[model samples]
Target: MGLQHTAFMEEEVRRGLDPKLARRFLALVWAQRGLVTLSVVLLFLFRLCAVATPYITKLAVDRYMNRPDLPVGDRLSGIQWLAVLTLAVLTVKIFTHYFETVVTQVVGQRIMHDLRLRVFNHLQTLSLSYFSRNPVGRLMTRVTSDIQALNEMFSSGIVALLGDLFMLGGVIAVMFSLDWRLTLATFAIVPLLLGASQVFRTLQRQVHRVSRAKIARLNAYLSENLAGMKIVQLFRREAENRRRFEGYGLDLYRTHMKANLYASVFFPFVDVMRAAGVALVVWYGGGRVVQEHISLGTLIVFISYIDLFFSPLRELAEKYNVLLSAMAAAEKIFGVLDEKAEVLDPERPEPLPDIRGGVEFRSVTFAYEPGLDVLHDISFTVRPGEMIALVGATGSGKTSIINLLCRFWDVRLGQVLVDGTDVRRVTQRDLRRRIAIVLQDVFLFTGTVADNIAMGNREKPRASIEGAARAVHADAFIRALPGAYDAHVSERGSTFSAGQRQLVSFARAMAADPRIIILDEATSNIDTETELLIQDAMRTLLAGRTSIVIAHRLSTIKRADRILVLHHGRLVEQGTHAELLAAKGMYARLHELQFEDEAGARGIVQAGEPSDRA
Candidate 1:
């Protein structure tokens, strides 16, 4: 059993030294090189001083026992010298411990700080597609829980393991120096202790892995359900959600219980073994002392050494669990760090200067997944200052076209050109800076209303922010609030209505002063009153900029310079509202289907069928 445990530990250590883990661990330590080195040095010095204390005690015991007839002056002097030596060693031990703790904490915090920032920055650089595929809770776990686990490994686990190793070595050396036979006798149970540690560590690691996974799943479930609490409540799913949550909670509890069980059993087993070792040492060493083969001091020292040896063994057993957890966390964190950004700027890219907003898609084709094209080989052009409306059924590639034009994803075939220059030739930052997007699913950060509006233009003056808000007609409502521009917006802007958030987003886009603007279902969620307000804002914002409006409301597109109707990733018709209605094709059918109850369709027909509009 002892040999098996040793071999298993050796294997685990070998696995831990794998190139990837080694690099990550070493990098974390190297980040605080000065503190790490100091901690190690202090730990080594403290172990040396601790090892010498028992020897000093042994010397005093032997001198007192062997020199009963010594002169009083010599005896007193000898006692004083021993006392001084013991005091010195104890003082050094105390200071060493203090410094070790200080250094370890410093190193741990620094490494954690760097790791967290790297994770956050990488998350920001990842494409939207990656975010769409991963849940927010899962990502949060990597940043918070995983980094915290590593902090524990560095702050306590590493120091404990190192201190135990040094102490164990020192104790073994002193024991052998005192009496080899007694030392061998004391070590007879070492294999058994090692075996038990290995078994406990392996079981504990498995339990911890299960526990962490369960916790991650629970977090994900909680985040999802909370975000959609309204839907859940409306559907009367309280009991069902509770039942599901209970299952996840129970899974975590079971895993934690299993880990505790392993720990509980291992400690008691180790204590029993320790007791047996102490008995063997005292019985054997006591006999040797009676036979005068060894002094009483030697027996006492042997007993002390026995205790010292087991102390490290016990501590090592405990630290093994922590080490395993840290290793697991390191694997997860490095996996995130190793993820390369799929969307990166071109090397030696040309800088975009003064964009004219002439966007041309030349036979562009795209797909979120391979062999599944969302936008087929479609081509179109939007001249400067032209208002183009894209009308299509859901999944007709209208949004995909805007996405391609924005360089969110590059075209799989042909190219997207801005002012006859391939978008791929310039940096995404430069390209995006020239274009402003107002999405239907408006997102607002947690901050004051002014901060949210100025997000797109950080250097914009306060007056500019207020002016933009006024243009979108958001100023009236914003000022009506308690804090006006300073009113706090909660996360996701839940405090405000959907139409209000949309209007705020529009104001934000207008603040950026981009050459090209995209309104993606911008008015779809707004009421008629708000839509009319937004229509006026849109006309003002689009006056001198190229605009692409994706609208589900047919009435919104009737006044566009030209309307393109898409069906199944293909352009089925391109004409003004009146011309399309006259053509009596897909557009006319779609218009009648959507606006049959409204008088806007008749007003559109009454307007002259202008060719330039198409």
Candidate 2:
């Protein structure tokens, strides 16, 4: 399932141009019509100036420089004015080109900015299953390199291709008007130029498409290894991982070189063809000049126009690479945008009425994959203000239950109701606002302690943030730090210990002040002393709120109002701790295992005992 995106990327690359996708890209341009219009106007003016320069040169040579029929003074005066006119035309062309480049660049940046934001916002709306299936590196390529490719096309490829076409047309028109026979003779090499372009286009499509896909795979691989670098080092897999990375890097290098090889051959082939056209003009048009059948100025103009014609042809060949890459990138980016969110809000929603912290699972069933149910016919209820503990082995659907409760996932069968309303009846935003979950692996953003505590809500007063931290007993260590609440926290809060990070997570949950608090193995990783601190903090954090606790430590849940034991996705037992022990069922067996493990190791009876199950 994780490799599905890689396969899709490869397939999309192999596919040829899609008109539907081209139309979509055109629509993006249409959205910024004003900037595009200005760019086009500037480009037209530049092309006009480009066309005028050669004609002015012809006028200088024929009417002013060579025509003895005119007076010597008149010829001198006319030649000087022609030089001035030539300078003015060149100056206007330079300014128009500058403005055109600037406008196109602005359009490209604005479009890329809008597109990146759209992809980001769409990702946020997708269900957790989508993220679980896709790699972060692959998505990063879509938002970064892929969009940048489109920007390159917009900034340089599209407008330049248009300008090149116009320049070619303008040159051909003027040359044909001057001498049709010479224009036709010089254009004899057009067939060879066209043949080279066709072959290069085929090669470019194949190599560039594969190269882009390879880049995406490389990024995904790097992101995976870097994120798990600690595990790699612990397992002594550095040399092995590097070999794997080298393989990826080598694959990308070979693909790019293949594309470069095709370009290298094709570009010089264009130059040779351009030289062939120049030779035809020198041999054919030069003879006509000698026979007095054409002016020397007309022969020179023919040479100049031939250069103008082939120059754009060469540039169009170059810009085609950027165009192909942008097309492939657009397909991938649009694919992401088109992903259908599995969980969507109803067209019309029923609002929750006066939400209390009551929760229920009525015959709920779930599966992360088809035909593989993780939770089957599970039913439970938690009244407002009740603290219930879920006891289960790993893969026994404990976390799945929490996921459903939080609406991170929806049940496949039956209902998960909160405050007597089906969770699907309301927007996810409204539903999750009432629940705050603390997991065993706490995640903290890069910010100050207070910023993390407030969780990006600027409206959260400093007094309130500090009060929440103090409630979780995190204030003691926080105050000991350099800046106290204002201290800088590095990425993922790497500066904090596991226990300290957990304590801050508790503070975050408390700050939200949710009506329902979920502790999903929140204290399992803490040391004995740190656990004692959090155990005291939990009492205050969970007070007056409905709480659900999932833990491997049996002692932590001994004080729970009720305990439910699960095995293999089924509810096998439920009762108070002492009541379940007296019954001697699965719950009693788990308690016995923990009790034996703790007693044998420490020779001390302590409530802080670990269980072998989640």
Candidate 3:
């Protein structure tokens, strides 16, 4: 073997028997049982060819070289036949080996692909709370790096380990039948081989666990920093961010080196044990040949058998280390899949009619984490086609109200009704389809402008897309682009300005054509000129649909049919904008503060100004 050969492994990974995870993993393997069975069978056939070759060599040597009792011509012809048979067996073995690789590789790739999709689909089912607690970098590792480890497990690790066991069995059975005493002598080093293997496996596991943890940590830090790089640069904290990143990078490098150290030590240790086993067979078998107790052919075959048996044992250990990484990866993947969706749809969902846009919150109280209430005893209602505005101090649960209405989070104490139906009773899909939201921080995926506008709804025609853009007054800017509606948008619409992104978002919501519109600070980023265009669209858009607008600007707030002021998560005031303003309460003070902060026009504070003030 090459001195430079090293096993590819991660940190100090501990192999666990997470019983529930094991069963789920086994079920996945069982799904492809037919292909798996055939691959194993081919591996077994290859082992048979390997074991038979040595025995044929023994026969050729004895009959042609040592047995002068037969004619020389006959012995020479027999030797030629043996050589031809040897060539044929090796040819079959090589072909079967190639086919096995093909089958197993395909199986491995297919399994990983399904696992990735399964994880992503399950993620979609989970509530926003799950994502809030977990970071994107950590989840990305589960889908990419972790899945790659499992691919190795399926393609070559576990299957190769099985083949090694079969090969070992064949070698042991054949050797014992050929000569019992020499087999016993060869078995003398078996205990040492087992002992060394155990020690190496323990070391490998420790190294692997360490490596995997560091890699996952590094990924988390990288993803977070990348996303917030703009803020980091804006604050002039580049040095601090770089220092933190360097610490994570250093930790990963240390753990990786430790894993590599163990791997290098393990393969060489196996090689030494292999050498010991071969030496024992040679010493005993040579004595037998000298005494004429066993044929020279038999002695030679025993030596060959020693190589076959020990080689598999060595391979089994290496592949077992790879399997440890797979087991760890499986634990993480299954952990995500097992998490229950905190917000669930009814088993037998109530039928939801086309929404007339009436929304009511009847004594609704909510909290993200238990005992930390963000909203308390909140009750309000919007009649069909009514435009209501929500105004409050920061942390007064204004956003929480929107979350509950959208069913992103269910209210703890009361019913959030769309039309006459409690949101919990209405299926989530049906409920969401009837409402549209345009958020302040727009999230646009990478695609053409038209595709982003239409979002995922595939039934929309180009004309409909254009109409939505025009209604949002976004058609002019979109048409000015190089490819107009077909122009490519970069990540999160970074290619466009803030106003342009908001307009694109408005177009998206309009295309959905929902009965209720939630504009949560949607125009906070628009310039005065663009704000005028949007204000024009707002009048037309909110005409026949119920709308919930969360705004701080006095102008936008005053336009609402009614205003509800939340103070410390409690509804402190509710009535028409003039009525609340005249009452001289929380609404009056909030309106005064807003007027003091901004000049006229749409009355929105510019983007990047204080978004929330308590």
Best model number under lDDT:
2
lDDT of 3 by residue, 194-299 (tens): 8878887777776666666666767877788788878989999889878866876776677678777876887787778778877877787888889988899998
Which pairs of residues collide in candidate 1? 561-613
lDDT of 1: 0.79
How far in Å is the alpha carbon of 90 misplaced in model 1?
2.9
TM for candidate 1 is: 0.90
> In terms of TM-score, which candidate is stronger, 1 or 3?
3
lDDT of 2 by residue, 1-614 (tens): 12244432334465556788878888888999999999998998899898889899999999989889999999999999999999999999999999998999999999999999999999999998888778888899999999999899888788777888888889889988999999899889999899889889888887778778888888888888887877999999999989977877887788888888998899889989888899989999989999988899999888888778898988887788888888889888998999999888988998875578999999999888889898889999999999998886677778888888888888899999998899999999888888898877778999899999989999999999999999989999999999999999998888899989988989999999899999865454457888788877888889999999885555556778998888888988888888998999988887776655764653222222223121
Q: How many pairs collide in each candidate, listed in order?
A: 1, 0, 12
lDDT of each: 0.79, 0.85, 0.81
Instruction: Give the worst 10-residue stretch by lDDT in candidate 1.
Output: 605-614
The digit string of per-residue lDDT tens for model 1 on 1-614 reads 12122111111112332466856787778868888999999988888887888888899888864678888788778989999989989999999988888888888888899999989999888776667666777677789988898899878788768888989988988888889899899989989988888788767776666555566667777888888998999999999989978877876787788888888899889888889988998899889999998888888888777778888788887777777777767776777788776667788899799988898989987888889887778888889888888887777888888878888777789899998889999999899988988877789999889999899456889999999999889899899988999998999999898888988988999888899999765444457787778778877787899999886555667778889888877888887889988999998887776655444533222111111001
lDDT sort, best first: 2, 3, 1
Error of 1 at 561 (Å): 1.5
Better of 2 and 3 by TM-score: 2
Query: Could you estimate the TM-score for every candidate?
Result: 0.90, 0.95, 0.93
Instruction: Indicate which candidate wins on TM-score.
Output: 2
Least well predicted 10-residue stretch by lDDT in candidate 3: 1-10
